[model samples]
Target: MAEQMSRGSQEPIRNRFPTLFEVLSRKTVAPLDLYSFYIYMRDQQRAVDYLDFYLDVSQHLILCRAYVRRLHRSVFEDTPEIEKNSKRSSYILHDAGEGPSGEKGSIADQRLSAFLRSDHGSRAQSPQNSHGSGRSSPAGRERPPRPSFMTLDSPGDSSSPGHASSSENVPRREDLRGSAEKILYTYLLPGSEREIIIPQSILHDVQEAIEGPDQRSDPELFDSAKDYVFQAMERDAFPGFLQSKGLGNLVPQSMMFRLIIGLISVFGAVWASFILILRDKPRTTRCWLILPYTVGIYFIFTHQYMLDPILALLGYSEYTLFDFNRMREPFVIKTLRMRSMSMLLFFLLVTVATCCIFIFVPGKDL
Candidate 1:
């Protein structure tokens, strides 16, 4: 129910975004998940940034779980952006002026981390104001230290461009699950550089919450300005955003909402048609008048999807979700599209049923 009110509603702008006072009121017990954001430039962190290639969220959980499993190797040699010690993930793990031999972690954190560098400067260009001003490009800051030939440990033969073997130099195409998850989490930021991913489940969840006793007015604004520096920059070549959960059932995609809306509309139209039929002065002009003709036509042709164009124009048009189908799988679209063809037939049946119940009953209808 994320305030299902249209854009031109009566609420004020400040009310639209949740306030600190509001969050403490009706917070749920659901665990909060944190995802990192980043921006890359100047030919650096190729492995860390490579997740941009497969930036899809349709089957996110499956992808992330798979990537985590695949990313078993040690972290990359160059990536000192992440802290490597045992106690806990420290916020500032970069070259703390304690020299270049930074702490090293398990082999897993090291795998492709060689490509990452800390975002010591502002990543966002400018915030989008209420006045609709376009996004300003963020000024480039001084570049951080580039990775050297030495590996993560305090010794020779680390994963820098120079000392790496030719085999490791080639990008590890197979185990990119972590990178992909990181990319998706990056885009879920406030004023994200990436386009908004309208995940249906999360959207629906938000809606339900908004409609409940305590609405989550602005879930995106929960993150503070201090944490905002971690904005990850990316572009979606395909731009088909899946659910926030990252993966699940294929049938009820975001488009399914539109389809449900379509079906409800058709039902309303049919209901209105029956009301008109009841109001028709010539009681003999039955509601089922269209049925015998439907049977006759069905014999002439086995099945035809759409209502007649004339009828279609008069609010009987079958909604063809070509725009929606683009996101659904071929099998789903085919199955739904095939079922949709019978809508005309269903309408005829409903119409006939309406007439019989109204006109043929012996006593005055209830």
Candidate 2:
């Protein structure tokens, strides 16, 4: 459907940004895929002739959804300190209420300008407060900060108070000079890669637009768009039948680590319980000792509290678990069933071992 729509409706995006589009075409990575769609959307908006055309293609919407996924990854990666620093500051001249004569405008002027901008100005005009809710009014409260996957070198300090404050709070940037030199020496110049820098602020706008699009306003488009997103994820997740061989290998390495921890906890608990059962201790006392271990293990495995510090280092939350939909994937279901079967087999083996010890061993007289 997307290919059909691409035939004659709009010029190929590749023609507009050839080198960058080429990288997008070849790479299935999240960053490049999303950045391409963002550029396409921006170009469509800017081109006066393309005003009648909007992104309606299935593939295009999938890319937009991929953008949302990458943004979530960034959020998961952010540290608490980074989150605090990235939050929108209320230090605008209006919030502080106008400086003296040569300073910022008066409170009345600030309010008046804000009103005018809300009513008539393009969202781009109010970059600091622009939202994608399709409303003219500014957001009541600032949302969490979103950092870009990549950024330019840090800007030098500015003498202006406002610039100083913003610089301090904004997302960090990479030092391109040193990195660029290495790339220039090692490989041919990736012209598109060099030119395709999307700042954290612009990425924020792209995120709002994707996540906050009103379904009721355009039901058909909304549903189709979401479906495309799901399809894209599923396609990437299950690229081939054989490649999807094992359950443990189905998810990323990070998720596999969690699964391993859960399995180990279950086995460890079973062994400990078997040992207690063999002991001559009173049943109530044994139960009390083992019960707390069971509860603690459950919490550690499910909540992943043990993984919190490691997840934080990667800019993700340990408590923020993966989407429930992932667990519903056919491969995931098969894997889980297999694990349960294995557990039953292990339990039977342990029980047999214990029975043999009881039957064959001679007991000492009390």
Candidate 3:
């Protein structure tokens, strides 16, 4: 889709910054890219809560899909056959063991089992049953007959009025609906700790889909929500993200070191300038000052913006200082290191040259 859209446009896609969707959909943008963006939003922008909500919802949807698939397989494919065979075996055993005392014993056992089953069913269907308590039912306990409303053909179909009396499977559907509602209230609804800031129309759409009669989870709703989030970030947050100082927030050590080096270079430049100006010197001696002055000026300009144009002239037209800072490729890092070292070396050499001119070349005196 993105390729087709790019093709339809006059501008080459590569010349433009990629949207958040493009960045996320592409496999090449690793987790580190997202992490760096998260850090920037968290620390610099101070608006990371929406992103947090988006991530949580995304994870929840993935888990819900996996769980639904597993549930579908277990309920439709496995349970009925296993129950039929087990019941048939139990009936045969009871018939074989029928005798005077055995028959009486069997009757007593049936009564007790019926009572236990009824009690377990009531507990399982109770609204008051806690989430953890549902799992404590005995393993060997018989499951109630599969509800008529649930079918192999359409697992997501809503419960039919005819099967309303068979309340056994209703709890499972209710549990799914209730879980989804909980997530909605916790993240998307008003007063949530990390409420997502989306358009009211999108929020309404999400609420309607989740709260609808559909018994099964809706993957389309989640996909739409994710798309809206990506679009919102791309439209609103992306420009700020691009303009922000690259990965400085992510790698504070490197940023601090770079700042310190820049300060040293600026100081060296100023010191060299002052030394040349303060003493009245022959033009021959002053001519040597150009070297230190040039080195100092180069460092000052290239520290931020000037290097970009020079690199553009050298065929790296698309590269910016932001890209340089954010990229962790071996060559990029090596280039940055080399630039820093060169700055330091130039500073040292200029200092030594200034000292030489100060000592060796005598200043004019009356």
Candidate 4:
């Protein structure tokens, strides 16, 4: 049973990682993957408007789906029940020789009717109608008024009569449509404060689909827009993100090891030079020491070049010498590994040769 549960848990992760890897590997990314990249870019201080736009479109699509589902459920399932209840109550009032006006409605029904009527009246009086308002300014684009039915109190609080009554009031279809449109204008419209930066063609396509006479929400409305955003990120943003120094910071252990090796190599070279100079040896014997110094110095220099950031700040012509991104390339990594190994071997051989010359080949007195 535990094994089965573990497999179930792993299933989602296994599906997700492949998509994540594809995005990281410079392959196509989905809308959700784009959001992950957006967060990274935001932290790295890179431009992320494109990803932001994609996220907004995705959210708008979700809201539309929820609106459509609720609308259908109300129209097909709940409306008939409400109508029958009203008719039955009217008949009871008639049998008692009392008009509908004389019958006192339930407290919950009275409050709900009054709230809906007031809300509908306010919407009618407002000058900036949601349907006619096309790309209004941020100040002009107001959020739809929250229905009085929604309260901060928990739904499970059975003690509060207000909460109990409010919970029964379902928002009318028009209110839902207006709220969805308000969200759409606030984020997705071209001139709004939180405007997305999608292409005009995709923007127009979305607008037409949402504002059409049919009023039906189709899932495919945002598909083209999503594909366009993914392509844009893959082409432009993803490459730069992969090459960023922020990405290099992710592997501190490797960088720390390189720094230690570089410092030791430099110190060893300096110490070896001093030792050779202090010895009272013939010029020919001293000349043999150059081989070790050359190998040691070269290794130190390459290491310093790879790790130093000061060179870039100084506007050095060879700024690429210290580029973390360049150093991370597969070919460059392989070349550096081989070169470091070869240099170490060469240094050892030169040290051995120099020592042998000093011992076997007698140096003339200087």
Best by the TM-score measure: 3
Question: Tell me, what's the RMSD of every candidate?
Answer: 19.9, 22.4, 17.5, 15.6
lDDT ranking, high to low? 3, 4, 2, 1
TM-score of 4: 0.40
Please list the residue runs of candidate 3 whose C-alpha ends up more than 4 Å from where it truly belongs after superposition.
1-19, 29-32, 79-179, 208-217, 222-224, 239-268, 281-366
Poorest 10 consecutive residues by lDDT, candidate 4:
311-320
Flag regions of model 4 displaced more than 4 Å: 1-17, 20-36, 76-127, 131-198, 207-220, 238-366
**lDDT (tens digit, per residue) of candidate 3 on 183-205:** 56655777865576777887787
User: Compared to the true structure, candidate 1 yields what TM-score?
Assistant: 0.24
Clashes of each: 19, 4, 0, 0
TM-score for every candidate vs. truth? 0.24, 0.22, 0.47, 0.40
Backbone clashes in model 4, listed as residue pairs: none
Hey, what RMSD does candidate 4 come out at?
15.6
Estimate the lDDT of model 3: 0.44
Ranked by TM-score, the better of candidates 2 and 3 is: 3
Candidate 2 Cα errors over 4 Å, as ranges: 1-148, 152-254, 289-316, 319-366
lDDT by residue for model 2 (1-366), tens: 222224563433221212322332333222123332343223322321111111222222222222223323344456466554543422232222232356532343333234322323221223223333344333323212112212211224231222322433221111111121222222212242222222445333333333333111111222333333334433432233112222222223334565566556556656655565565444454444344344334334323322322222223221112421122123233444555456445544654554444333343323
Q: In candidate 1, which residue ranges exceed 4 Å CA deviation? A: 1-110, 115-282, 286-328, 341-346, 361-366
